[model samples]
Target: MTAPASSSTTPINKQVGFINAFIAATLMGFVGFFARHIDAQGDFIAFSRMMCGGILFFAIIAYKGRLLELKEFKLSPTMVLSGFFMGNCLSAYITATQHTSIANAVFFIYIGPIISTLLAVIFLKESMKLATWFALLAVFIGMMMISGLMSIDSSGLSFGMQFSEKTFFGDMMALYSGVGYGLFLFFGRFRTEVPGDVRAFWNFVFALAGITLLFVFTKPTISQMTSTDWMWWVGIGIVCGFGALGTCTIATRHLKAAEFACVSYWECVVASLFVGLMIYGEPLSSAQMIGGAMIIVGGMSEVLISILGKSFKRPDNVTLKAGSI
Candidate 1:
């Protein structure tokens, strides 16, 4: 028999992993700050983040002697297509950040989980529990509240319903990004042959190539930004590149799928909080605070329900099950 994680001092190690994830999320929150500083070069900033982050990702993998892992794949069109979709997701996400507040951007993109779950139910015949449905409903309501779409003031400028043309376009792009993200996850799950990390690495590589070509095609000049902006770009590389990816890999190692998903809710909150306090210094509206709380509560509720079901938990969470890539 093996030792329990709690008894083996691994919990402390896991706590360290959680801390990494928090820092990663927080640094990601600063994207808006960096974006605002670009001065007529928001598109370049968005493109460069992914390209630079992808380079950092590969560089780390090379240092770790995992470049040979890339040889295992024969490079099928399907994988390439999936990777292109993944690239689009990342590119669209960065683009969305330029158009809207990070709080709104992150919150809006999380519609992925809902879309992913529904897709699983329809395509994979996976049924969510009743509690999960409640969780979904709660998340939907929270999204509306956060987006300023749920209500309005008499002057047509309420907290939640303050939709302008730009806001609508931004939100729509974010929704598309979420769909690409959902499809990316679904496709990632489809690759039974590839290891998850290997798959992740290739996705990054594919994204680097695809987005770089697109970036060049767009003809963005990087000469306009300052040294400080480049430094922020580097921060985006380190924080989001290795930090988010590493924390996610480590967290998933010791966590249930529900646990992983539960902790992920923190990404949006941390992003939003950092935006509200650090970037804008705008106080959180009552609706936003309440909505944020609701989203967390809902995500946690679904996760806990999964845990309680034991047998009902996702295969990723089960100790003896064949793992997914």
Candidate 2:
């Protein structure tokens, strides 16, 4: 049998792992900050991030002598499709951030888990526990609350359906981003041969190429951005794109998925803080706070059930898994 991970260096390793995970999550939370500062269109921002991050990802692989690993395992067609979905997600998110409050954008983007679960049930013939169904309902209710369609305002069950046009469009974009990300997750399940880092590298490569093709029809707003904006774009690409992805990938090797998830959820809370207190100064309304809580609880409930249900889990069943990439 292999030795337990509780060796002499285990404590130090665990400490480093926790720090890396925290840093990664914190950097992800700063995505809205960078997006707000960068004066460019969403697609252009997405393209820049993908191109720069892909370069860095490939450079790291080459430096580490893993570039030749491509000969042993090429990216699958499914991975290319997954990358396309990821590009959609990134593009939508940047646009949503520009139009909506960061809290709303981040909260709704988490709907990916619910969408991915439903897609798995429909497409992959997966089964979910009763708890998973309830969680889905909770998330739906939370979404309605966040959208201002349904809320428990101070007047008690107020039908204060007041959604500005920009926010409404932004909320829809955020929801679309979640669906795109859900599809990305769904397609990613089929890439069993490619290592995670290699898959990430190619995913960004595909995203860069796909987004570049779109620019041929429409002018990229990058042409209008100032030098300062370019700096911020680079920062987002290196810090939020590559830095967060690379560190989070490493953290998984040291921590259980459940432990890493607990860390990952903090990204939303941290983002809310930045959005409300630092960046936008727009606090989450009472209804939105309750809704956000429900969303988090619902998503985490499904994940917890999966972790606890040892025998009930299956590798091919997406409902029984919780992942972020």
* lDDT per residue as tens, model 2, 1-325: 1111232212213334455567777788777788778888888877766777789978877877777765655556777877777777878777787788755666566666456556655665556667767776775666556545566756776544334775998888877888876666566545433454676777787777777776776476556789999999899889887777556544543433333443454465556656545678877777767765875686567556655675324332222111112
In candidate 2, which residue pairs get closer than 3 Å at backbone N, Cα or C atoms, i.e. clash?
none
- Candidate 2: where are CA atoms >4 Å away? 1-28, 93-111, 143-150, 154-178, 244-268, 278-280, 311-325
Report the lDDT of model 2 for residue 240: 80
Q: Pick by lDDT: which candidate is best? A: 2
RMSD (CA, Å), each prediction? 7.0, 7.9
Model 2 TM-score, 2 decimals: 0.70
Error of 1 at 211 (Å): 1.4
Q: Please report, in order, the local distance difference test score of every candidate based on alpha carbons.
A: 0.55, 0.63
Give residue 104's error in model 1 in angstroms.
8.0
